[model samples]
Target: MAPKITVIGTGYLGATHAAAMAELGFEVLGLDVVPEKIEMLAAGRVPMYEPGLEELLARHVAGLPGSTGRLRFTMDFAEVAEFGDVHFVCVNTPQKHNEYACDMSYVDAAFDSLAPLLTRPALVVGKSTVPVGSADRLARRLAELAPAGGDVELAWNPEFLREGFAVQDTLHPDRIVVGVREAGGSAEKLLREVYATPVAEGSPLVVTDFPTAELVKTAANSFLATKISFINAMAEVCEAAGGDVVKLAEAIGHDERIGAKFLRAGIGFGGGCLPKDIRAFMARAGELGADQALTFLREVDSINMRRRGHMVELAREAVGGSFLGKRVAVLGATFKPDSDDVRDSPALNVAGQVHLQGGQVTVYDPKGMDNARQVFPTLAYAASAAAAVAGADVVLHLTEWREFRELDPAELAGTVSVPLILDGRNALDAERWRAAGWTYRAMGRPRA
Candidate 1:
């Protein structure tokens, strides 16, 4: 018989994981403390916008018409402990307020709530991104708290899901890694069976010790953050020298060794993962007394943060020195396109900065308006791009949504008070905007 799966915590990671598990032919029960989120998911509605996630959820969530009915959700931990043989703890590990360390309070709470109710042999798999050596401590805690102390074992399996591409990433992962305390333990056997579908579909399964598994997530995020900052650093150099960073990136990306995935030079990276992961990694290294080895990550972080401020400066320059009383329209608010997540979003940061500088900033995003309003409530918001740019002195294209790319520069030019526009993401077509009687300016590109 196949092991029943339970996902603890139904936020972005947990909701996607639970839906994906159901798609893979497992009976999945997802638990969350938030009543509204649980109510939403139970009705086959995703709380936030992720491409294709709601449609995917609709196909599998229990009550929807023509659904598989394999997935169910609840707020009760007792029901979760009774129903699942394999529990995946997919709680968020956000950065602690005013500190570089990762906040493990959610992970701790999930374990505390579920451990004592484990009256049978089960595998508790941790899929949350955590500091290294956390699995060992959590394993000890589980043994101490659970009634079936020896029967309940722990496994560390950190997730690598990107916000926008979460569904595809989960269903067809590049690789599946599990960290086990004992070599060839029952935890390994059970996880193998749980992931047999993906394994059969050519995803490599790497079995390793706990520390390496945890490090894989942070190290990978740190490297990706470095790659983004490295290119943005080149953009800064390109701007000073009047050179095009796009051409530079394109030429360098031709080398097979340096593939062109995260090389897009823009307003830098921000969302739920990259920024916090690198900082937490640095903090963890400091705790383990290996801080110097990863000290360059500080510079990587610095470069990324500098890009956001640089965009703000560019906006001010476009509006003639100061933003005092200028009607500035921001074209996007989310960190990136295709998702509604605005946590640590660079676009919103720029919008907020411009707003603070007395620019009458009206922000618009296809899906991020609600979340953006919550984060930066005082900033002006608009229902559409045309509405945002109406009578605007200058416009800033901060997020590179496909809809923004599809927008007609001619139509937009007619709405703005001034025809000046700044492409923060470097994603817009400069020639088209320029031809439409708008001054198109972008970082690291020659002025037209």
Candidate 2:
């Protein structure tokens, strides 16, 4: 028989994990402390904008019409303890306020609440990204709290789901990593069985000790962040030397060794994962007395942040040296397209900065309006891109949404008071905008 699964904390990770497990043909239960979230998921609706997540949830969540009736939701941990053979903790570990360290309060509280309810044999798996050696401490805590004692086991299975491609990533992961204390424990066997389909379908499964598994997630994110910042650093040099970064990236990307994955030079990376994960990794390294080894990450962070300020500066320059009384139109608010998450969003950060500097900023995003409004209430918002650019002195393209790219530049040129635009993401077509009687300026590119 397949093991019944329960996902603790129905946020982005947990909600997607529960739905994917059900799609894998297992009975699943999802738990959350927030009634609103649970109620939303129970209705087969997701709280945030993630492509295909709601459809996946609607396909299996019990009580929904034409559903698989294999997934359910609950608020009680005791019910979760009773119903599941494998409990996956998918709680968030956000960065601490004004600090580089990750806040483990949510991860700790989830274990503290659920471990005491394990009265029967079960495998508790942690899917949250935490500091190294966290699984070791959590394993001990599980042993002390569970009434089943030796019958309950702990495993660490960190998640690597990207925001835009979360559903596909979960159903058919690129790799599956599990950290088990005991070499041949039931926890390992159960997880193997749970992921057998994906493994058989060609996803590699790597089994290792707890610390290595934990480091894998942080290391991968740091590498990606570094790759992004590396190109943006080149953009800085190009700007000083009057060179075009886009052509430079295209030339270098041809080398098979460099591989052109995250080489786009623009406003830099910002979202829930890359920014916080790198900072937390640095903090953890410092605690482990290896701070000097990762000092370059500080530069990586600085370069990334400098891009936002640079964009703001470029906007001010476009509007005659000051943001005062300049009507600025901002296209894109979420960090990236296909996601509504505004946490540490580069687009919103730039927009907020411009607003703070007194640029009468009117922002427009295809999907991030509500979240962006919550983040920056004082900033002006528009119903559409056309409305945003109407009577604007300058338009800033920050986030590269497909909708923004497909927009007719000629139509927008007719709306703005001054047909001057700055492409912060370097995603817009310079020729197309210039042909429409608009002055298109981008970082790292020579103005015609």
Candidate 3:
């Protein structure tokens, strides 16, 4: 028989994981501390805008028409403990306030709340991207607090879900990694059974110890941050030498070792994961007396942040060197495209900077308007791309949404006061924009 699964803290990671687990034919109960999240998710509605998440929820969340009746949500810890055979702790570990350390309060709280209630044996799997050494520490604590003691085992199974592609990624993961203390024990056996479908479907199972599993997520994010900053650093050099960073990235990306992923030179990476994870990784390294090993990440972070300032300067230049009276149009609000998460978003950062510097800024995003507005309520938001760019002196395309790429540049050309566009993502078509009588400028490319 399949193990009944319970997911704690139904945020992006938890909610999606719960729904995906139900999709895999398991009886799943999801729990969150927030009543509102439970209420919303119980009704098959998502608070966040993730593509395919709501549809997936509606298909399985209990009480909905023609549903599988396999998924339910609640806010009670005892109910979760009694119901689930395997519990997944999916709480967030956000960065500490004004510090580089990870704030593990949520993870700690979820574990504390559930561990005391586990009177029976259960496998608690952590899927949050936390600092290294967290899993071992939590495991020891879990054993101490739970009445089941040795029977209540804890394992680390870090999530690698991308924002826009979370649903597909969860259901058809590229790999399934589980970190267990005893490799062939019941904990590992249970995990193997829980993920048997995906593992059997060809997603490789990487069975390692706790620290390695905990490090995978932070390490992957740091490496990605480095790759993105490396190209942006090249963009800086290209700007000085009158060379094209786009073409240069293409030339370098042809080397199979470097590959073409995360090579696009733009305003740099931002969202909930990369920035906080790298910072927390660095902070944890310092605690372990290996700070020098990850010291290079500081420069990588600097380069990434500098790109946002560069875009603001470029936008100011496009409007004649001052933003005092200029009407600026920001084409995107979320950090990247296809999701509504605006946490530490470069697009909103750039838009905020422009607004602070006295530009009458207007922002637009297909799905991120509400989240962006929550973070940056002062900035003007528009309903559409055309509405955003209307009567603006300069436009900044910060997020590379496919909607922005598919826009009719010829139609937009006649709308703005001055036909100027700065492509922060470097994903736009130059020929089309130029042919439409609009000035197209991107980082590291020669001016037209």
Candidate 4:
């Protein structure tokens, strides 16, 4: 029989992790403090928009594969401690209020609640991205709290799944990194068992000490954020040099060393992960008294943020400065395409900025309008891009949704008050849009 696994905190990470574990043929129990979340998950409903997650949940939650004992959801920590052989702490560590430091309260609460219930020997794995010392602290806490005392082993296993590709990333991860104490245990073997399918499919597994594992996640996010800011910073230089940033990026991408994955020169990155992770990483570095080592991230963050201000400036320039009464249409709201999560979304931030500057901003997103409204309630939301662009002075293509890309420029030109467009994602076809009698503008491109 497979080991019984319990996944705590059923947000995006926990939800996908729990589902993937069940699909891996484990008797999985998912626990959350929120009763509504557990109730919803138990009934085969996902609270957010992630592709393929809902279908996977529905399939497993209906009946546990040939038997009725498949995936289970509960709010009780005691029940989880009794059932699970390996418990995964998958809680979120979001940024604190008005600071770059991560709020570790949720992670602490998970350990506080579940540690006392461990009556016997069990493995506790942390999948959340945390500071370097978190795993060491939790290991000591588990030793003191669990009835099994020193028998409870702790491991750090950080997740690298992006929001849009959470399910796929979890089921078929790029690599697995596990950090354990010097005493050592069967964590690697158990994790190997848990991820047999992916391992067989050619995913590498890395094992190391606690700090290295913790550093890997923050380092990865920081690199990604740096890549994005690097391109956006080039976009600024391109604007001054009257050169094309897209062509520059394409040229640099041919080097193989500077691969063109996150070279998108747009309004910059903002989601639940990149922005917060980089900030938290910087904060952690400061706390560790090695602030000089990570000081460059400050510029990376500033460059990314400056792109938003650049978009607003472009918008102002398009409408002859000072948007006192201009009608502006924003094409998308979510940070990126394919996901409806709007935490620190750049598109919505631009919309709000434009609205605050007296521009009548009408925003439209295929899926992010509801979430965007929840965050920016004062901004005008339209049912469709056509509705948003109706009688608009300028159109801002902020988020690169496929629906927005597929939109006919000629059709939009006919409806809008003006045919001027600012492509924030650099996704629009220049020749096609220009041929349609619309003035097309994009970031990192020579002005036409």
Task: Tell me, by TM-score, which candidate is best.
Answer: 3
lDDT of each: 0.94, 0.93, 0.94, 0.90
- 60-123, model 3: which lDDT tens digit per residue? 9999999999999988899999999999999989999999999999999999999999999899
In angstroms, how far off is 61's CA in candidate 2?
Answer: 1.0
| Residue pairs with clashing backbones, model 4 | none
lDDT of 1 at 157: 91
Pick by lDDT: 3 or 4, better one: 3
Model 3 residue 134 distance off true place after TM-score fit, in angstroms: 1.1
Number of backbone-clashing residue pairs for each candidate, in the order shown:
0, 0, 0, 0
Kindly indicate the candidate among 2 and 3 with the higher TM-score.
3
C-alpha TM-score for every candidate? 0.98, 0.98, 0.99, 0.98
lDDT of 4 by residue, 1-448 (tens): 7889999999999999998888888889999989889888988888888999987887677444543347889899999999999999999999999999999999999999999999987889999989889899989999988988987889899999988788899889999898988524587777778888998999998889999999999999999999999999998899899999999999999888999888879999999988989899999899999999999999999998989988999999999988999999999999988889888888988999999999999999998878998999989899988999999999999999889889998888899888999999998898899999899999889978
lDDT of 2 by residue, 227-264 (tens): 89999999989989999888888899999988877888
For candidate 1, write residues 236-268 as lDDT tens digits.
999899999888999999999998788879899
Stretches of candidate 4 exceeding 4 Å from the true structure: 62-69, 182-184
Q: Which ten residues in a row have the lowest lDDT in candidate 2?
A: 180-189
How displaced is residue 211 in candidate 3, in Å? 0.7
